[model samples]
Target: MGIVSNRQNASDYDDDMKRAKAAGIDAFALNIGTDAYTDTQLAYAYQSAADNDMKVFISFDFNWWSASQGSEVGAKVAKYANLPAQLMVDGKVFVSSFTGDGVDISAIRSAAGCNVFFAPNFHPGQGDFGDVEAALNWVAWSNDGNNKAPTLAKQLSVSSGDNTYKAALDGKPYIAPVSPWFSTHFGSEVSYSKNWVFPSDLLWYNRWREILQESPRFVEIITWNDYGESHYVGPLSSPHTDDGASKWVMDMPHNGWLDMAKPFIAAYKAGSKFPIEFLDEEKLVYWYRPTPKDVDCDATDTTMQGNPNNSSGNFFRGRPDGADTMADEVFLVTMLKEPATVEVQSGDISVTLEASPGVWSHSVPMGVGAQSFKVTRGGKTVDSLSGTSLRDITDTCPCGIYNFNAYVGTLPAEAAIDQLQPDGLTMLSQGLQVACPTNTLGASSASAT
Candidate 1:
């Protein structure tokens, strides 16, 4: 998991580490910038990781760094190279970066004066990897044909960037990135220009399946807490929202995606082809934009064109690219212990499918009104979500801006509940355990076990 440095205390880092560890994450890549508090935050993170029995490594953010400051970067990394929580690969310190493609690797290694395993996120064709032990592909989303300020257009395929990086490494270790969604909104108020939404329909499920198939040496979830981009999977914390991201992040909880990922993480570690066997309980995780696709936003917002650099003079105040392609649909994934009927109803439109004892995903056209979901077996309700607990789908945007962010929820809504303990791990409830019959059933079976 990628954790941006905004933590306030050791307890804050401890809380995040415990939750990540419970989710089957092996380590935390602390994303550090040149902020003055970075050193203090790193100290807290390292000590917290050790207390939680988790591993950590430093990931330098190049936005505030320059290639000429290789010595400074090396010195910062050397400071924590010997920490007990430091992640090591083959007895060497494991270090990474966000976008230091031009940084001198030899200079960093020489200054650190230790064996280093460098795996920076140098985009394809941008940096030399001769001295690198591994490479990390940072392009987690698919884009339109335009390279500069490309629109987040197609469903990401492994062959798009993963295959290219793997081929370039020529058998070196590759760390692949997996994320649920990506949406960023910023105007002239912020110095950097960013406003776009990637096509994320069922991306959480699709990407995990791709990871199990490709089986890279390692996988990094795009972020654990990056509210500004609206892809955070961690519970929203107020202290970390000083960057003006709370406008879009508050009240938008994504923990449901983490609940859906538990089984996938277990399957990946076990080298299983499918995550069905790893699923211990039945669950129905669903997500959708609170507003319909046709809603208009304030005219002052500039739509993201090709290249955020704005060198092509494509910048103008309007709707974002790929916004029109976003399907007005509700996406859901179901894990079942027996054959059951899954139904999704939005307003007057209802869609139903007979799902078997396995992991399955489907989407239905979204309707404006109260959203509801249910699972039935032998004419009896097994699990469901209804009433006012869920946010209603409205025709108007809540934020008054082009809010493309999603609000995720689960069917057995209580199944998503988690309580953190003093030990830093969550006390999970065994809510949806079901007993299956002896007879093995196929996907065609419509009867309950």
Candidate 2:
């Protein structure tokens, strides 16, 4: 879902549409709240979608709007229902909401003056709603509940039960939701900010694999740009400067996550083995906290109000210490055309592995100085790049919250490759390599190019 709160221009929507469209997204489920500015920007978004031959629909934010009033939401939805870009499912206008259990959805259908295909995340602790055409679970944090849920088994059961139950009853389609990562340390003060990290360790790949197995009708990437919660898989240029949430991700390149998603989408649609199409080039997408969980970036805000694992509620029950789930290792998702030996070196430590083609990940522990990586084939280096320095305090702002941004760096395409030799090393084009520090760091050194 895309947030409409940012004061965007036609150019902004146009650019975002182009990016998402190229990535195999057909429509945008605009997650809008009750703000006058958002209402205005929504119009521009619809027009831009139409111009770009893309589809747009509403996923109302009842949390910010009047929850009890259905008429208000219907009226707002009706305004864009007739637009050329309005998303329609089997001739009915597609409609959804972030939270709308309190609102009368039947009344909303009547007020819209159109046949609405409504699927919403109306079920919290109250359980699933039978009235909607489909059900959505917006907050499936982790596959293994190691960090987010109580135990690994609970995580597996919860995911299995939620998907199985929703996809079975009524023969209705369950929207299979997949997110790359989750964190809200930037907004820990808010009620929803229980810093949850699903450990991107094979998260996107594994979740897509699960969703494909379930055979759900639709798939929704948790968010394109919910910058505060930090599951954003899109560019982070939009400002959530009000709470200084932008500082957490600022230039941290999460775009590679989106780029990596293209292959997954192709595989999901094809319903076959995911093809590693880009064999001509290689790229590595990696992320990690620069500092360990025990290391506090800010010493003053030690009240520990935002620790997700330590919170007293069911949503926040996991670890009593509320520590981070990630290990002190750089998680690597590499894109390769063929077999190659990849090396992650820092200080005196260097780990090498024989990597095959497709999306494979490996965790390399942090050492010292600036971390660097190299892709060697037949004993010759093909790709190499320097990453962020492993500093004690990587975060710029000494706030109590954690800095979860991953410092990413792509291997330069122009880098020279050694010539083929009889010894067996062959000349290969440089593949991309990206990595982040293990401690708190400001912004990102990652480049999309």
Candidate 3:
């Protein structure tokens, strides 16, 4: 996210920082254009970013700033020789939040030892800006950035726009910045959609997903703050915490965007395609399971929140990496049944699941891949499933990383699964896991055909 105009001063930035770190936020300094302080202030914000662990962007919000700042914006950012070249936490790097008319960004990239990312100020979620000019400007910005190469282009083959971003496609280097947001009760958020998060009225999830599909490079999630905008996906809240289930909504380093960002960044880094569920105007991603239980278990033990052995395990409830979500009255396929004779290939046998109504999970040790499973029970027969291809999954939510992700296709349904998508993949941290409904999801309701 950008600067909180009121919090330009380091001390004042506390609230903003608190919010940013909340829902899984990564910080990008946008002080360049604020014109909020003097040369000393800029220097201070620079140090403040370092102290706060935020990467300073040459936002130089100069387009409309006072003329005096206009001249110094570029030079000032250039002057900060020691500022972070990339986001200290996620490695996105110091960049220009403000596009249009700037210094030779290539020179800046070389100086920073990284290619700069471009963050355009445009989101219908916040409020439509009336014109596509900003979008057009971003496109222009990409072409402009592309004309001149930056330093790290050699080391990293990142692009400003992979596809959705027209500018980058024209040959720019900045990743198409897609600001993913979330809303949680405790100022904690991942999407603008309300899950006790920031509220919105758009299918924001699908909105951003389209954006991600448009770009193959970076996609910056908007604000990392539970900033009061009802658009906050960060744990930063309104000086209040809602006690329903999640406590992080009120705390940080304990709960906030920082924690949420890990899974997001990882998902993107892994190139996992996000599986989204509609939440009002905002299309939000799932952070916590409807119930806190093992994805494979149908049981719930709310009293044993602290019990690791309990099916309601403290599994991250997180989506990135390997996380298992507890489903109510549902069971992940724990024991696979062989319907036919087993055919072992080489040394192991592959088993295909019959998850038309259930999800299956796999339990395997690390360093085990390109390997198959064994199925032998009372002369039970096992059919072979394919482990040949890995799906090129995209982030359900966009973050600035060329991530890889995937999910298995579920049985065809008559309609979109209730509350959940039929094709959604439940992440499992412990064993290889998949989720299936004991009953058909949204069997009666079709997709409004």
Candidate 4:
């Protein structure tokens, strides 16, 4: 669905209806900014939605152009806030600000309302949306800031927008907001918009495709009338201007923007079976937080000689003198994004140990010029080498005989890992190494070499 929450004028509804009906838009969201709207005005907006057969949504950017953190902040919000629990004549709930916690939605949803949508933090930075993971989760959380139900866009913004990633945004939602008219940087020949062009917007489309590949969220187009940010997809004309320099050129969007969206929407629906976005792939529509781990495993419980029964980690190449104990689950892949450290004690020997973070980081030393386990870190995880029958000159630490492990497959492009998964390792004491054959190995002459 495409959302245009900052709209004004009663006639604009007629115009929007006319345009949407002709455009084949499945639905459109409107932002009814405040309760100052009379019952008649509210009814007009809904009636227009019904007449056009367009699924309608309403919103209010309570903050408008005000700072969210000013001392007058709450007061300002109160001034423009909708009646604590008032419903529009259409009985639909609307948002004042698209940001997650701007209003208490859960409380209002209990009122007589039709539908409600949330517009989580938008247009942050030039490269992407800000607080990406938070934004992505909104689709699942219904844009609930405090875990409120009946959240915003319970699904996704198949056509919503995030102005421009002037920042780094996690592409959980494919939706983006566009207002070509407001942007002097795009769609205009004005000296102000020297770089914004049909091509500039392509950056977002391509980037979004990458994020979508990881999750199943959709996209959103921000405003249908916001022609100020210079990122608008609509006309950038000032109705009050008479001179040719300050007037809007009608039907400009019909000229090109829709054409750009058509093939894209079509291919997205087609599921990338025949899609192209420089380098496209199947996309994800949703995501859940990964399994959380207890980072503070044990500040003083790890053994000097780690467990030998561990298959996850089986390569030992440590003793760099200040070595500590082993960790649980953490590896090169995830350590970087969320690093961790722990300490273990072995009677009078307590050491704080830190893990190596990176793909194929901290190689393993099988023994005597030979290594047993290797990992690749990037994207997901993979083996440093996925091979079948191999011949080694030194049969050192055969199959499952090592005492160390690290993460793999958390690096980029030049993949050291191809197929194998995390070969986690644990430390084994010299005495214990001697006690366990599988945990220890001696160099042996190999004929396969």
TM-score of each: 0.86, 0.79, 0.36, 0.34
Q: lDDT (0-100) at residue 202 of candidate 3?
A: 23
Candidate 2 residue lDDT tens string, 139-208: 5555443435435445453366465547444578777688876654422333443444555545665676
Off by over 4 Å in 4: 1-12, 21-24, 35-42, 64-96, 100-102, 110-201, 204-216, 235-254, 273-449
Model 4, span 1-20: residue lDDT tens: 11222235445466555654
lDDT, candidate 1, residue 235? Answer: 73
Greater-TM-score candidate between 3 and 4 = 3
lDDT of 1: 0.72
Residue-level lDDT of model 1, residues 1-449, one tens digit each, is 12334456777777778889998998989887788778888898899999999999999888778877788888988999999999999899999999898898888998888999999998767777777899888777766534212344534454478987887788899999999888766545445556667777788889999999988888999878777677878876423523445434544678889888988999999999788888887888888887787887654233322334444333334455557657899888887778888778887788888887777888999899888887778888774432222567788655445667887787667434332122211111101012211111112332222
TM-score of candidate 2 against the unseen true structure:
0.79
Kindly report which residue stretches of model 3 are placed more than 4 angstroms away from their true locations once superposed: 1-26, 31-45, 66-71, 84-93, 99-164, 179-202, 207-215, 224-230, 234-262, 274-449
Clashing pairs in 1: 148-307, 149-306, 149-307
- State in Å the error of residue 199, model 3: 12
RMSD of each: 10.4, 9.8, 19.1, 24.9
In candidate 2, clashing pairs total: 9
The segments of candidate 1 whose C-alpha lies over 4 angstroms from its true place after superposition are 1-6, 145-158, 299-316, 384-389, 414-449
Q: Note the Cα lDDT for every prediction shown.
A: 0.72, 0.60, 0.31, 0.29
Better of 2 and 3 by TM-score: 2
